[model samples]
Target: MSHLVLLSGWGCDARIWQSLDGHWPTGVAVSAPDWPGYGARPPLDEPGDLAALAEAMSAALPTDAVWVGWSLGGLLAGALLDHLPAPRALVMLGMGPRFCHPQGVTEAELAAFRGAFRRDADATRAHFLRWQLGGEPAPRTAHRRLLDLLGRESPAATATLATGLDWLASLDVSRVLADPPCPVWRLAGEHDPLLAPEERARADIRLAEAGHCPMLSRPEAVAATLADIAQRPEHSLLEATP
Candidate 1:
């Protein structure tokens, strides 16, 4: 049985994976660890450093498991390519090799967010939540569900939130795509505002009528896709000559 590890994006805790948890295949074992400073997890010693953060996370992950990451989580997973004991496979959702894109969040926008966060963490978080849900088909419903999930956990620390913003402003993992440690699969929502058209085209699978956070708007579909990926023969991509 392949172990599946789900990593949530910035501003979100492990609770974000709750919907996906209930829908995973019966035999598959799933683990979703909260990132430092989120939920009950403690902040990293060096909060703003992505590499250090990835290293910390790698130390806690199972030796061999398929790593599935969403948004910022995807960037961190890619950063872990050489850090962790090789993952069985890697999957990215609603993100590409780099977070910054012509059609996605720009550096200036990120800076503005950082400023807002510095001034009022609660207001910034609330604004961010609304912005994220704006692209969903059912914005009100999606927003409510996300808020409800987040309400269960303590708000993420200000330092961690700033670190996440710093990551968005500078981190890029485009080079890692050249020779991934394992088979790599990409999933994206057809209407994800955060993903540019070119990025969406790169997806191995795309969810129709879904936005950035598909696990919330299309949990069953995401679960089925994950199950299928988990069942594929290990290194099938490596074996197949392109």
Candidate 2:
């Protein structure tokens, strides 16, 4: 049986896939890796960046696992793809080639997120919901659950992650996709403000209306896509350089 390793976006818990449980295609065993400071996992040290953290997390999975990631999780999945011991596949959701602005982020943007994480927790939560669901709004019950997760997070750690966007400022997957050996599928919401539709269109993308977090809003469709990829044959051997 094939193993599916799910990497979740920043600040989100493994609960992101709760709705899609048991929906994966047959012959697949799905596991959602808990990001540092998120899910039930312990937080990492101050200097532990995503790359270092990813290296540590990858040790938990078996070699050659299919990686499905959303947002920051997608970035990590792509970065770690070549390093992993096994065959890999990438399914990116709601993430563009670069997250930070080309010229770089202003102090205002960075400070605002930091302040929201500290003084006005509700606003931070609301902002996150707005960004992820494209203002479609999560249910009140689900929204509260997300709030709990946010409450559990360390402000310093989350802030450090916010500061880390600079690492992805200039990243684009075009060169990587130019002649990808492994199968890659990109999914995006037409109204996704985080990752524009135009950017996602650069890859083999699926359009939906659920904003950034379609896995929650369009669980059935996302589940079907996962199943589709799981059934496809491995393509790593096809990536040999000419």
Candidate 3:
């Protein structure tokens, strides 16, 4: 049985995967570790450094586990390719080779968003949450549940959020995708605002009517997809290319 590690996106903690636990297939060991400065994890010694953050995350993860990452977490997972032991598989959701794409949020927009966060973290976080849920099929319900989860978990630090934004503005894993160390699979929501239609077409699996946070809006579907992948023959699970 493959160990599955679910990695949440920016502004979210391990609690984001709460709904997925009971949904995964029995006998599959799973873990959702919070990134530094999120949940109970301490802030990184060198904030704003992707390599350093990836190293910290690698240390916490199991040596042999399939890594599934969403949004910013996807980028971090890609960055881990050279830092950690090769995983059984790597899955990316709602993110492409780069965070800033012509059809997605641009660098300038990200910088502006960072500025807004700096000016008022609370208000900016609220706005960010709402913006993310805007494309979901059930925006109201999804937003409410996400808000409730945020209330129960420790919010990411302002400095950590800034560093994440910085990474979004500059990190690109296109080269890494060109030759991944382990089998890679891409999953995306059909209505994900962060990914363009063209990009979504490249995914191995697509969830209908879902947005960036499919794990929230379509937890069962996400769980099923992961289970399916886990059951597939190793030769059939090939590395994804940009």
- The models' CA-based lDDT, in order, is 0.81, 0.61, 0.81
* Residues forming the 10-long window of minimal summed lDDT in candidate 3: 233-242
When sorted by lDDT, best at the front, the candidate numbers are 3, 1, 2
Q: Tell me which of candidates 1 and 2 scores higher on TM-score.
A: 1
Task: Write the residue-wise lDDT of candidate 2 on 156-195 in tens digits.
Answer: 3554445434344534555555555466667676656565
lDDT of 3 by residue, 1-242 (tens): 76788898887888888867578887677788988888778999888766777678876666577788899899888887877787778899888888887777877788799889889887887787778877789998998888776673337888888888877878788888888888889999998887877888988888998999888899999998887776666676663433
Give the higher-lDDT candidate: 1 or 3: 3
Backbone clash pairs in model 1 (N, Cα, C under 3 Å; residues 3+ apart or in different chains), count? 0
Best by TM-score: 3
TM-score for candidate 3: 0.93
Off by over 4 Å in 1: 152-154, 237-242
lDDT score, candidate 2: 0.61
Scored by lDDT, model 1 comes in at 0.81
